[model samples]
Target: MEKVSFVIDDALAFIVRAPLVTPFRISTGQHDELENVFIRLHASDGACGFGEAAVATHITGETVAETLENLQSAASALRGRRITDPAAVCREFAPAFADNHAALAALEMALLDLSSRVQGIPLYRLFTPIAGQPRLTFKTDITVVIGSVEEARATARRFAQRGFDSFKIKIGKDEEQDLQRVLAVREMAPGCTLILDANMGFSAQRMLAFLDRLDAGGARPLLLEQPVPKQDWEGLAAITAALEGSGTLVCADESVGSLASARRAVETNAVSAINIKFMKSGILEGVEIARLAAANGKRLMLGAMMESALAITASAHFAAGLGCFDFIDLDTTFFLKGDLSRSPYLDDSGRFDLTGAGSGIGVVPELP
Candidate 1:
């Protein structure tokens, strides 16, 4: 394949507000709407690519204002740069973006998208060599955010009716209510795989007790995600050890923000799975982490923050192209209030297909 190179003629960043159908609550906070940053990189050859930065203050500590400011500086630095290798550019810019992973991801995503378009190939082709093959489709899990038991049940039923077989339930607020919500969701979505995400809401002992209760009720989830705080390595290791033979995997989310953190988590055996989010690891680092996790035999899961289809589609292309993730949590787009125009790869069912997309991410969202 001939390499296509082009100078970045223009770079721009803007804010996009996407409203959710309902307030999505986690242990740390709640979101009724999302204010995120979007990036557009225009190549000298008239090709353009898009990216999105979903700002989660609780997770990445990046606000929209700071993200925009940082992006402007990055845009200034990226202009006139010849990009034959987008991933290499991303790595080159890593040091400067140490404090802002989401912004870096937006830049990397835009570069990759633009490069793929310049080559007239789907975005996944850039990653197929690493994956060993191409993946055509992937199923995603829908999240039932922290809410009342009735609300959870209703959400589960609605999604089940829509052919969603995997459910990620947000818990770790009120112990009793959280348990009730889990059980209610289970009742509504029978035989479905359940993933419990606490978002750093519990102590090790408390999380164990909650697990015991779930086991007693025969509703043990398939995975327990980030029950302890992000920096609580001791708590995470203890919980992982306690769940060694309990048929549940301990997955790290907030704890693995960078490649170094992910390496530490794997070396310490603190968790059995790693949750890879572009907003946390950026695109290149996320791929490296995925490779690292796979090499170390750690289960891989791909997730997204509160984002529109534009960002989710980019993630979908990456995941589908790589074909390595064991669990898919790219359901945030389903929570957005509107048509699925931004996410052309996603469908009414919780599935993403990249076969139909054209060059690049194959999604040009109608941003307002």
Candidate 2:
């Protein structure tokens, strides 16, 4: 790798707690507010870039305080280092920061953003010489968090009226209630495709039974995501095998967080699709996993935690740059109380147009 003529001079970390517009509930718990760590890295040439880490205690097992400490420790190690290659930097730091993947991911984002800015190119351009498209457009699915049946219907109707054609329903709390919520959403938005995400709440048998019930009710979802726990590889494999010719995709989200896990998922045929989230694997590993999944014919879904526009925009650039993702679920920013950050993308209905983005993820934070 050719060495870049820039040295990291300083690093700063900020803790931002933003309230969600509404409670975002999954099988694990509910989140009314999200705490995120933002890292700003300065280069020797007076250029700087930003990165964000959404601290999910249940998902990453790192609280905001722990992530802050981790980021500070990483910043010290990153000082005075020349960024010859951002991916190499990420790999080199992976072992030292193995306990905090989200922290390392934030650092990787800042490094990539800084490097791309230094080169006077969009962040996505650093990954691919040819642009994904002149406009970098992609459609995103809006999520309807776990709620009452009426709430789900109202949410679906509102988003459908706004032009969203896809809905990801959070389920797995009560199979019967979950079925009702799905039916409610489908009734409100009859033509929209449904993606059911249990977030590792159900067992293999329970999920299979639920699928049978759904089929009986004549309500078919396009995807079933993480119906079983993350460690239940056999359960995942069983579900995948059960859905062999059903035209329904079984996706592994929490199960496939890293390259090793993704390889195992592919080898064992645990699921047909893998969800790519930078918070889980960091930017470099996420990209590597995406390539691995694609090469093995596993479908790709780009997703995120409850992040602000900073990380969401970075993810958008990643997805648009690679152009390999089959589904985009980067709509977490909409749950924020207000605009926590700015992106170069224009949202029309569920589609994003990144024609207005400048270099380095094209995201500017509106500090809270």
Candidate 3:
């Protein structure tokens, strides 16, 4: 095997407009737009890999300034390291730059992209069982962030009209208002599957009451994501219990931060599924989480952090290879004005094809 190494070849950041038609609040207030960050890694052998840092201040406590600082620190560490294994690079630098999950994720993705290229295999094939299953197709939930019932209903109608069959609504603004929003969307798009993401904005009492209302209304949610804060394991258990056998699955997104968290969530039966975001846990850790979820009889969902096409397409490849994710939320690229890379993933009927081969993710468009 050739000795693997990485050089801090180039780094750049750009601001993009990710405007939401609604206010987009849950625990926090309105967010008009999101700041996006992208990173590039060039190997000594003329191979390059890409990653993204897409974040919101309310979601992961990462702002544009802090994310940039973390990237700079990672870039500095990459100046002269002889990285024989990309995973080792992550293991070494992750602790040094702890708490910056977004930054760590970017570097880890770039390394995986480069490493896969070196091996001439897709990143998903490296991890998943590829024997009997056809290449996976990903379908992400279209989000209707906090908004009026009318606006939320309108958003859901638009997305459903655009071939999206799954919908994720941001709730926890108010119990009654959330109910109204969900009801409106259900009424507008009767055939679309719905999931509620509270974003850690509810208490145990609020969650139970809200579930009661949803049950009474006959609106069966596919899953309830992060109904309580990450620290409130007991609350999550309560929520899970209340919805058990009701056909409403519970998923943990914010609560399952690492492999350890995944194990704990399983041990405690906190959720029925896990939402794996490569931006939140890096590729290796994300894979580990998926394995843990599968071992525990829990399903997996590949979620994104509002990334550009480069990052989202990379995730699409990963999701395609996994073959175990019950759902997908890799549509972050749809919100971008223009992606830097060409050959982005496209699904005319809400079904994406991941037949590309070789490493460094097969869909990277040439940068002009």
Candidate 4:
């Protein structure tokens, strides 16, 4: 076997604005572009690795500027040090900068990438216990932005024709409008898996009413995501209870960020499922959250934060390795203006091909 060789020497981050295919809106806010931060780490052995993060003002209220500052402070500790234990590097930094999740995510990703390169294996191989065969690809669900009934139908039809079997519809603008959006998509693709993302815009009563309307209309959604505000655990639990046995799963999105939040959600039974994102939970923390969710008998799904290929691929590898995600929302690369990495692109079926050439985030492209 080849010997492992890696010593941290330099770390840097750069900003890029990746335009979206369409304006994505939720209850909190919307954006037409992703303010992304790209991280690069150089080792003493003349090898390098890459990581990226998408800073969202509405979700985490973290901007590229803020993430950059935190990245500088967080990554500085790794310089002149040899990274023999990537996971330990992340675990050690967890408590000091618990608030800087996006920064921590980027930094953790860089360390994992560096580790993968040194070991001459894929990033997921370094994950928990390592999968027996190391699954390297996964299908992603395409998201339909909040829009009129016609736009919803059009979006569903477009992706359906491209062989996508799952579609996530953005809702929560208004009760009646939200109902119509779901109906439009269901009518267009009745066989496809459907997810309605409210982004914490609904009240408990409103959620129940909408579920009633959905039942009346025969449009069974795969799940309802973040129907109430993040802090209102009572409301989330109420909605989840109301929808129990109704075939519609309630998923927690914003309520889960760090392990603390994940534990609270699990202990309180806030929802039947969770939408895990590396943007909120760092690479290490995200996996831990998934383990916690599974242990609690809660279904798990994976999502992204307007990331480019580097970050999206990293996340896909994480979820695919664990092999437990029931839903996937890592299709941000479909909205990106250009490819950030080679062959991390999704297939025609909307599945990410994580088995790409090169190591360390799979061959970074020419910085698009």
lDDT of 2 at 11: 83
lDDT of 1 by residue, 1-368 (tens): 23668999898888888678788799898778878898888888899988888899976778889888888888888888887767777888888878888888888888888989999988887774345677779999999998888999999999999999999999988999999999988899888999999999999999999999987777899989999999999999999999998889999999998889999999999999999999998988898899889889889899988877877888888888788888999988777776533477787888888887799988775556
Cα lDDT tens digits for candidate 2, 198-291: 9999999999999898888777888989999999999999999999989889999999889999999999999999999998988888878988
Q: Give the C-alpha lDDT of model 4.
A: 0.79
Number of the candidate with higher lDDT, 1 or 3: 1
- Ranking by TM-score, best first? 1, 2, 4, 3
Point out the worst 10-residue segment of candidate 2 by lDDT.
126-135
Of 2 and 3, the candidate ranking higher by lDDT: 2
lDDT of each: 0.87, 0.85, 0.73, 0.79
Q: Runs in model 3 with CA error above 4 Å?
A: 1-25, 29-31, 130-135, 340-343, 357-359, 362-368
Ranking by lDDT: 1, 2, 4, 3
**Cα deviation in Å at residue 150, candidate 1?**
0.5
Error (Å) of candidate 4 at residue 284 is 0.6
Measured with C-alpha atoms, the lDDT of residue 19 in candidate 2 is 83
* Candidate number that wins on TM-score, 2 or 4: 2
Please list the residue runs of candidate 4 whose C-alpha ends up more than 4 Å from where it truly belongs after superposition.
1-5, 129-134, 341-345, 355-358, 363-368
Give per-model TM-scores.
0.96, 0.95, 0.88, 0.93
Residue 20, model 3: lDDT of: 40
Clashing pairs in model 2, backbone N/Cα/C closer than 3 A: none
Measured by lDDT, the strongest candidate is 1
Residue-pair clashes per candidate, as listed? 0, 0, 2, 0
TM-score of candidate 2 relative to the true fold: 0.95
